[model samples]
Target: MKKNKTLSEMTEEELVGEFTNASIAQKEASEKDKFSKYNKLFDRIVEIRNERKIRPGDRRRDLLPLLTHDNIQVRLMAAIETLAVAPDAACRTLKEIKDSNWFPFAMDASSTLSWFESGRFRPE
Candidate 1:
């Protein structure tokens, strides 16, 4: 039989330490599972995308393609994530889509970009 551990039984540092020796692939798979499991718990993907530990250049490249994802929420998250790293690089793409006929979806992206530029919302 497996012994269950309470959340309080493990400190954050202890939890991190347990995974410290994991291979990169193992760590990524775990993170993906966690992200999918808690996707609705706020913008977790965006948070991951903004993590300093992620290679900024690689993230920037990945985010560009996500901007065109079929899911509007994914696209919005990509826009936010891209802006967090390279606001100027994302500005042109965002401006092109801001006036799209997608109603509130496009509007929301535009609003988020505006807020980011005005410093109303700081990423990380």
Candidate 2:
């Protein structure tokens, strides 16, 4: 039997890799309307959130560079996740995505920004 390393047991690089993979998976799951799978992926992200919290540094900032990633889903999730540590860059990335007019992702970005602006959304 193989043992799975918990998020806390993973290094920063590994954590980032997990975050990227999960973000992509969640995006695809949502696109296919696989709500259960999407929710599970989101749960993984929530685990990553705890990983970030338990670490000493501002680990969430590690995702800042991903704001410019080629994949829109990666960029979108990175922006939303890092909003607390990098508001300017995150908001800029979200705005760019929203203005790109790329259908559902653009809609997602717009809605996220709306919540952010209206004080309805707060990244932990």
Candidate 3:
């Protein structure tokens, strides 16, 4: 029997690769199963919330806490992904962060949320 690699043992690239592969595989398997798979992956993200090493967009809800991550890249990506999924909910959070020191990221989130709310980006 082969031992599975723990997420902690994987490099950032490896973790992203695994997530991408899982996403693709789940998408191809069955439309009805997609949500379950996505939820499972999301659960995995929740399990590692404190690990401080998750890939961007791993968990939609993770964006809330990441709005204040020390790394701008992480914060920006989280804001973008959160807006993409829930523009309305992101609006308030974005507003709260807009005047903070991380103005650039807050602006990105606010703009994206506005665009979505404006019907410029319709769901497919």
Best by TM-score: 2
* TM-score to native of every candidate shown: 0.49, 0.90, 0.38
Cα lDDT tens digits, model 2, 20-61, are 999899888988999999999989998997888889988999
The better-scoring model by lDDT among 2 and 3 is 2
Look at candidate 2 and tell me the lDDT of residue 111. Answer: 98
Sort order, TM-score high to low? 2, 1, 3
- Candidate 3's error at 92, in angstroms? 2.7
Every candidate's CA RMSD: 10.7, 1.8, 12.2
Model 2 scores a TM of 0.90
Over 1-124, each residue of candidate 1 has an lDDT whose tens digit, in order, gives: 5365432354434322222212223334434676544333343333343342344234344456655555554555556656767677666556656767575557866887788889998865
Worst 10 residues of 3 by lDDT: 45-54
Count clashing residue pairs per candidate.
0, 0, 0
Candidate-wise lDDT, in order = 0.52, 0.91, 0.53
Candidate 3's residue-wise lDDT over 14-112, tens digit each? 554454444344334334556677567555543444333354544455455655555543444445456656665555555655555465455665676
Candidate 1 lDDT (Cα, whole model)? 0.52
